[model samples]
Target: MTGEYLAGRGAYILGLITKRIWFRASLFSVAAILTALVAGWVAPFIPYELSLTVGGKAVDNILTILASSMLAVTTFALSASVGAYGSATSTVTPRATQLLVDDRFTQNALSTFVGTFLFSIVGIIALTTGLYGPEGRVVLFFATIVIVAVIAITLLRWIQHLSSFGRVRDTIERVETVARRAMQAWAEAPHLGAQPPVAIPTGLLSVYPADTGYVAHIDVAGLARIAERYGLTVHIAELPGAFVYPERPLAHVSEAVDDKARMAIKNTFSILPDRRFDQDPRFGLIVLSEIASRALSPAVNDPGTAIRVLGAGHRTLADFVDTKRGAKACIHLRVHAPALTIDDMFNDFFRPIARDGASVVEVQLRLCATLSSLAAHAPDIFGKIARRHADAAKMRADDALSFEGDRAALHMSDF
Candidate 1:
């Protein structure tokens, strides 16, 4: 209710200003026209019988000439007002200015037209009703000029208030920077399965330096739930913690430690394959985390369990490499053991590429599946997945596989 009242007040104020300007311009035009009509048509016919007394002296001829000159002056003033309005409108209308004050050219033109028409009607009545005396014409002409001046001053003040050159320049610069970053992110992001680009805001979070490196904290559970609920087949790196960017890649973290932790996490009994696991359906990650290391201990580990654990770890590592940006990458570990698991997983995941020729088709398929899964359930996460896939595809083509200029190239588009 308060908001509505304020809005109403604002609108009323605007209307009042508009009406004032319009009436002023109209009256000025009318005054000018009246002067012209009186000098050109009425004054010449002023009968000698209607001689006016000026300064207590009979000065009929002098009075007539003076009145005619005033009329001419008023006419020129009115014409000038109209011309000013036209010029102002032209200057302000082309660019859609951020400041409303600069838009007054159009407003002034509208007001002038209405004001002029009203003035004409009033002047015509005043003249026809025998109210056409030298005194009356002079008074009306001066009043009209005053009105036009007042309105012009008000409009000029408004323009000055609306446009701050410094502010506008700053806003433009910021907008340009944001746009550039967005474009670059899109270009660099992965897009497996030829999926659309992810719409992540660049400045959504601030980067903070941690003990190891810079960390970017973000919640991924929301995305995970969305993906699961929607039955998406996309690959999502659901790290509730912040992503760490270290100075060196795989330099601070030990590959052996990571491998050991990952193996342990995998040995832990997986909730995914358990009957009681799906009861809550939310313990998927928890279950995996618990069984990873416990069930895969070197003393009593099953080969099958180990393979699944290794595979899952590899998938997570792939996702990290594909999506991560900048020079350094960091892993956050609220659960200390998982940090080692991640390192080991990453090492093992990439180690195979050195000896064997990496299968482009396999990688592409994995990327497609990951992106598709993400889109189906968690479109937001899916967008991220799709972005990483696209980036991976590009990397594979550029550095890993030499399929340049090959129309029959293996790309997400081909799938």
Candidate 2:
């Protein structure tokens, strides 16, 4: 290990932080505190007569009520969000739950509640401590009323959001949105801004990882810099979502490198205990398949959801194929990365669901149609894999499904 901190890219780090629930809530709370102090700053411009009519008593009472009530409301909102996560895990799939945890709608609702509570607390503290004079009190009163209105609006929006917060359809849509974006990015830059891989040289030195796990992210720019400094050609052996152990070679260097260079190369790859959605587009496909598999389980027996996932998968893959034809060459000069294959993507998205939903005639029909549709869109790219999965799924369906009529209907499609 380089013993250097691996922070990934700045933009990637910022993306991760923004997805966090506490980060949003903390920002809101800080804003609320700052808003509380503004009353004193703007008080000088207000008329003294206006301050006489609106005493501190009304504002204090409102703040006290908000402070007391908002805590309970915030607690309840948190519980609901937690419950949604659990429901999504059980009903959808564990892999799909992280999206819920990082969902902006859920985070925003909780942040509003938490921020409002903190604002109330600050207002009450200021009033009791005589921090604001009469004009400040008048300003504070108007601020309290505005905040109350905001709270009311937030509550209304929260109620509407809760209706389908963690529902299977809602969660699946979220997954589709993320997967499509990742796929589009992958299509646009299949090599992650690195040059396409060339054949390995006769006798290159291999660089091994110190830790073992999935490659969550690769700092290609960092790799390029290292390659430039060492005057070496770097062939990446593993990409993001690929598992590695201490024994596995992460890259092959053209020549022997110093310890610092070796460590710098190693530190460029961020290996995590689990895969993340940002870089590895195929991980998202696997997750959608997992969700379908869970729905097809005997305990759940929701073939409709499985069929729906097939459509989501189809749409995501279709978008990739459409964008891939015009993809531009990557710009990085020193780093070489293997391109992600559509064959692997087809397997990641369709295999498990084909196994789990084998017996469901509707699911099989939908699966065949989904594959056939993709093949129709880009036969050169997906036709072979689509037919391959369709054949495999057909055999499974034929065995699991006893009725000949259902099998006849499945055979009706030319998938």
Candidate 3:
């Protein structure tokens, strides 16, 4: 089952690549031919190596041109194939997460497919043609292989980004789950009132005018800082922007949120704490502000030993600001225009939170739901951008198809 999932999904990802301009093998071929032609033109005449008359007709020049053309085509193909591998890996991961039943196994399969696919093709080419030889063709062939390897390495980082996403998704789920369970346990134990701590989800609250929306530029820094001070690890990594080689293409985010609390604090202060750490679900607290300062008290403790924190992200940020006097922080940039409104705000943050999760299955299901909503609302967004940027519009089509198909599968499973 695992192998089948890997092969099937990997192929699907590869199929996605075929539709993209970058994966069109012909371009690489053309480049190789051009490189050979240019090199041949500059070659000094050697009586032994270069002969205008070969038995009957002039052939050395013609052969050089022909070989160069072949080399160009081969080189282009090899270069483009690197992009193909990247696109394939990226596509397979998110789809498998949503479509496959067993996520861990799916992830393993996806990883294997990445390593195996690259190795098999390159390995076969190397084995069949002697990589080290006196023949120029053989030498050129090996060089082409090397170029392909470089491209593959450069592009495969997208797979790593996707893997990071999976890990982050898992961590966020735990944060939510542990918090929810802790709240429930606190409310149920002993003398709790009818109304427990009202826990709003992550994407909820009045996101400052600029903070709202599906656009990448959300005002998360304030919340991130608050999360840090409170002990939730915050590592702010950039989300993949428009299908480039992933690896968190963010340049310089003053602060990023991580799902781990201790790490968050450590990162915020830029200090390494003198303590060993493992992910423990026992650090929940409730804060009450007084005239002098804010007071934190243990609000809920689970019998099974789960600790959860209470308070919205924004409120936490406010607390951090109040306590710290003056500190650099994230603020919303408002755009008061006639076209946008509050519903946009609701969709921007709250909607995602309404679709909550605590496990991989739950996160996958929720992600599918959230993404579907975004796609339906913004179909032309990714479609238009991809079409304009990638020389081949097929890339746009494949991306749309993958996201759309994944959305549908998730919807079907809703039954």
Using TM-score, give the best candidate's number.
2
State the lDDT of candidate 3 residue by residue for 102-140, as single tens digits. 223323323333333333344334334543122333333
Candidate 1 residue-wise lDDT, 241-314, digit = tens = 22333232211111223443333322221111122111111122222222233233445343333234334433
Say which prediction, candidate 1 or candidate 2, comes out ahead on lDDT: 2
Looking at model 2, residue 311 earns an lDDT score of 88
Error of 2 at 143 (Å): 1.8
Stretch of 10 with least lDDT, candidate 3 = 288-297
> What is the C-alpha lDDT profile of model 2 across 1-415, one tens digit per residue?
1111123465556767788898999999999998888899999999999988786477888888999999999999999999999999888888889989988878988998999999999988888888898899899899889989988998999999999999999999999988887777777666777889899988899999999899888888788888888898899999889999999999999989999899999988878898887667898899999989989999999998998899899888987767752233465688899988887898898989889989999999999999899899989988898999999999999999999999999998768
Best by lDDT: 2
- Between the candidate structures 1 and 2, which one is better when assessed by TM-score? 2
Of the candidates numbered 1 and 3, which has the greater lDDT value?
1
As a whole number from 0 to 100, the lDDT of residue 35 in candidate 3 is 38
Question: What would the TM-scores of all predictions be?
Answer: 0.21, 0.94, 0.22
